[model samples]
Target: MDVIVIGGGIVGVATAYQLRAAGHRVCVVERHATVAQGATYGHGGIVLPTPLDAWFGPTFLGSRRGIVYRPGLNSSARRFAKQIAPLQAPDAFRAQWQRLRPLVELSRDAIASIEAGFHLEFEQREGVLHVTRDPREWEQAQSALELLGEFEMLHNVLSAAECAEVERSVPADPAFAGGVMFPQERTANCPLFTKLVKQVLDEQGGVQFLFGRAVESIRLENQRAAVELAPAESERKSTREVDVVSCDAIVVAAGAGSKPLLERLGLSLPFHPIRMLSLTSPIAYEECTPHLTVVDSVRRVSMTRMNQRIRVAGAAVLQPEREFAKPLSESLLEAGTALLAQSTHDWIPGAAKISAAHAWEGMRLLSPDGLPVVGNALHPRLFVNVGHGPAGWGLACGSAKVVSDLISGTPPSVPPDTLAALRVERFAS
Candidate 1:
């Protein structure tokens, strides 16, 4: 089989690697010079199934309220609601979650497989700390724990002492009623892990990476497809005809870029661009430093250990992509620091951490229904594997395998009903 993967992000890279390993001659067309230069470069690096209830499940109503009322506190909820609004209504995150949970689960399993395959080490530290200053939020977490049922597959509800023990940097604040520790989940070095996998893909026998090639257009013709490529490196411009490079199938792994292709095909996507932010500070071992991953419920800020450095990221905007919001992230960090001030004295102090901090803008390809599209497109010889939203890193592995199967006409590892929900046809009239 000859397959062309259209995107250089993790999802596309993973798909090319998988397809190549599966005996297909694969070529990747990336608009960027390097993999993960896009959205894959930012935060949310938890190789997770971390309390899936927050991102998906019954606890979302309050979560949504928490977002709109105090956007800083629960940024994801605000982002989720914002992204899901055009698809349904502003108050539609519950119904959206009903559509999203399965997709998140798929990402979880896929990421686990990827971790096992490459031994990709991305600053992986397990046991995230879910800290809350509000006692009521703690109670909410405890109740939501019951509602989660079997979905609490990898989490352990822990006492405050246990959380502090796992992360010595955390202060022993009594305001912290308790914590739900996702002991099995780990934070990753997103760039390092992505590059490692991409390196392997490049070394793979049948895979060819056309890096620095921005695809300008794609057209279906004579039962196949054609892609226009412009060199990203050469100052001299030239158009190359991909006619000589035939493909049995085309996988649209182009992240948010997949939107225009769908539109060009007269296909509509439940897809939107939701911006998420991350700020990284130097590796400070002060008593105020947060070492393990910690979640501040009200502020919607997430702190995770990224190698020698620590990153506090998690501000989602269900709005248009914006310029660097350094002030916003810094303020969120301050709020996070204040929340942590009560719980643990260990973390880089706010003033000390600012100079070393940098902000990034990244957008997730979101489906209106909160599910990923993972099947053939309305155009023949074309398929989709985009709109993964926040779970792209984790979902990359399973999604690639599923996309490979769809392209190869092979049976899937999961049930067909599961696959049906992800197909673009679901959005068709």
Candidate 2:
């Protein structure tokens, strides 16, 4: 079978790699000059199976303070409210986790298989410590431990002293409580991983990449999928003609950008583009930087060390229609700096020197129910492997494998019910 995958982010690249490996001719269409230039670029890069709850879970929604809605972004406020409505019901929150846990584990295994088979390296490190400074947040973490145990995930509860012992960079603040450490959880450079996978895919036969070309429209007719490519900007300026590409199957893995194409096909996906910010700075103090991922659950911020760089990411601005705000950069930098201060107070003075060039903002396509919309959509030849949100790095490989298996008419590695939960029709009335 010949397949065309739209988008060149981690999910699309992973799907293309899987499809090509399964003996199918694959072509990836990306608007960017290179792959992984979208949300996959400069991601937080923490790959963990625990804390499988979505952003709208009880831990977030039940808090006295709801989502921090910006003052001027009123257009998306209603949509953001609707997105969080599903989590209002306690049962719905639990169900979302039930749907997410299996995928997380499957992703971990799939990534391991890929690494072992291809001998790929991407500055990955194991272990992640999820800590909290608030007493209420600590109680929430303790409750989450029961769910982690039920999943049989490897984790250990730690006291403040134990956490400091394990991660020497963390400060022994009086407000600090205990945390759960997932020993197997790892962090890696997501863009580097995606690029490496693309390199391997390029070396393998039966895969083609169309870069710097936008997909204008995707339509199905006579049991085949046809994708009309918009003329490249350079070609349009030169008045060069562009051509459409037809294939036996099409996989929409274009992250937030997939929504527009799906809408053109008369399918509405409940994915809202939420902008997130991250700041990366060179390690000023070796002993001050953490060796493992450190997540501040109270602040919803995370800090991790990748080789010589320290990355801090947090804050979800749920505005799909608005452009990037210039003011948010300073606020995000302050938030990231505060996270670093909580972990390594000694390094704060030196880390404060980070400039705007090190700050990055990207948009994640978040589904209302908090689970990715994967599997077959309205058309038989059209499939979607998107809506992974912040978990894209952790879930990309497994989601790609599932979509590939579905396209190849093979049995999926996960259970049938799990696949059903991720089907596009789930949002249909």
Candidate that scores best on TM-score: 2
Model 2 over residues 245-266: C-alpha lDDT tens digits?
A: 9999999999988988999999
TM-score of 1: 0.81
Q: Write candidate 1's Cα lDDT for 135-163 as tens digits.
A: 77666555445534544456666677777
lDDT of 2 at 244: 87
TM-scores for all candidates: the values are: 0.81, 0.91
Q: Return the top candidate by lDDT.
A: 2
Error of 2 at 329 (Å): 8.0
Assess candidate 1 and give its lDDT. Answer: 0.64
Please give the distance, in angstroms, between residue 243's alpha carbon in candidate 1 and its true position after superposition: 8.4
